[model samples]
Target chain A: DAGITQSPRHKVTETGTPVTLRCHQTENHRYMYWYRQDPGHGLRLIHYSYGVKDTDKGEVSDGYSVSRSKTEDFLLTLESATSSQTSVYFCAVSAGVSTDTQYFGPGTRLTVL
Target chain B: AQSVAQPEDQVNVAEGNPLTVKCTYSVSGNPYLFWYVQYPNRGLQFLLKYITGDNLVKGSYGFEAEFNKSQTSFHLKKPSALVSDSALYFCAVRVLGGNKLTFGTGTQLKVEL
Candidate 1:
């Protein structure tokens, strides 16, 4: 919904291997965010971008990186996967920061062995 | 720092009965509160939001949330529960000056027949 899509809905990779997740939005929103969901932890922000080539760290940005080169795409990368990083990742977009409601993509389930 | 807390891990209600999922938040200045629902294997779906004006905000699927500024609470409620309403619910608060949102762990609602 919300014209959002995530590539590789499910993925499995070994620890120490690089992995990337893609989030695409057709809503032309100005803000995009990446978040990870785990049991008992709800969801934690990984990174966010306010505009192309402008990104910021979230509370749990460690060991992960993100890039937003265009208004429609935001990418999250795991330089080296870890078992602890295994979780369901979600991408969301908003028209603006204040008072704007976020719309989420389906989600990507990633597992690290 | 803005934060949200969902005190209950699980809430059970019978079909046709009223249901409520408690969510309280802490933030400086006025708050922007939101509620989202997640079914198994799906992404979070926006249910409702409270930006300003009336505290009682009605949302999709016959759901409503009340934002209580004095109590610092924004609880999700349904006048009558449906079996289809069983899902994981999350509450979030947006940062005052930023678009970033801080989320609560989540509450699993089970509506049984």
Candidate 2:
């Protein structure tokens, strides 16, 4: 298993509230990614960072934002949480040497009421 | 756009029986295919990948996948199934030179005792 950890294993928040999920990795990987897993949708990329301060939006980046100020931490924030944002969020890190393999964090389950 | 499909939502096999999970992909250029397994309450774990080498690629936990260029399929297979193998399996694909991956809806494999 990779040295990746996600904070707040589970959370329940009301609509219009702000939620933040954190992902930390001890692997010191260069590439980090945030993804959401929902029913009927396997896993969709929300945002990814190739390096510190270098990030890009993904297919489902409409309501989510990510930041990677350092190599060990990647944070995903929901500006104003909505019911549609209820899903399992996952963080992954890749060494870039082999893009084929990515190590993932345990995941965070968020529920919006 | 690159995409992956796992036709079955679930698969069942008794212990000692052979197991197979189907996956097909669509990509413009050469595809980098991968298989991952996820246990309950856990993140995705890398299983195997097909980069540019042999068509038959073996991975962890006695699992192997065959890359068929003509069919654009990378189906995972195991000669003997174990009850411990019961979990959710995901198929993913990345287009050449693309860092992002598109994943399938996932197939839940139930290896019965």
Candidate 3:
């Protein structure tokens, strides 16, 4: 376990509501990533942060946003939840090296109706 | 763009039988391959990775993967399967200097008694 924890392990909300999931790591890793897992789609990266205040979009960045103000915390927000955004969201962290393997959090299951 | 493919939607194997999960990737430069496993309701756990080294790499939980550049494949294999090995397996690829990983759709492994 990479000392990663995700808040709100499960959530259910109506469509068009705002949702924010938090990922906290005690490892102080330099790279943090957010991914959503859905049936038949595996895990798709939502967003990632290389360092404090530096972020980049991933393959499935739409409808989601991320911010990392500190090394140990990364946040993923759904500005307006949609039914299509219902999925298991996982947070991961790495040492930011090419050979390093990323460790994951326990994951949060969000459902939008 | 880097990409990964897992041809099988699911794989079934009996306990004590040899098992393999297929994975293939396409990348521009040298690729960094990875395998992850996710139990029901849990986040993905790192199994092993191939950065640069021998063709075979051992990982957690008595798992190992063979990297074949000729086939552009990094297949996950175990000599004998266990019931606890039943889970969703994912393959991912990242090219040199690329910060994000592209993942496959995932393969569900079912180990039966």
The top-ranked prediction according to lDDT is: 1
- State the lDDT of candidate 1 residue by residue for B1-113, as single tens digits: 88889999999999999999999999888899999999999999999999999999999999999989889999999999999999999999985577789899999999999
Task: For candidate 3, give the lDDT of residue A49.
Answer: 94
Q: Which stretches of candidate 3 lie over 4 Å from their true place?
A: none
lDDT of 1 by residue, A2-110 (tens): 8999998999999999999999999899899999999888899999999999999998999999989999999999999999999999999998887898899999999
lDDT of 2 by residue, A1-113 (tens): 58999999999999999999999999899999999999889999999999999999999999898899999999999999999999999999998833458889999999999
Model 3 lDDT per residue over B3-97, tens place: 89999999999999999999999999899999999898788889999999899999999999999999999999999999999999999988777
- Candidate 3 similarity to native, TM-score: 0.97
Better of 2 and 3 by DockQ: 3
Candidate 2 DockQ vs. native = 0.67
iRMSD of prediction 1: 1.1
- TM-scores for all candidates: the values are 0.98, 0.98, 0.97
**Pairs clashing within candidate 2:** none
Model 3: residue B56 alpha-carbon error in angstroms: 0.9
Better of 1 and 2 by DockQ: 1
Best first by TM-score, ranked? 1, 2, 3
Q: Score the docking of each candidate (DockQ).
A: 0.79, 0.67, 0.75
* Weakest 10 consecutive residues of candidate 2 chain B by summed lDDT: B93-102
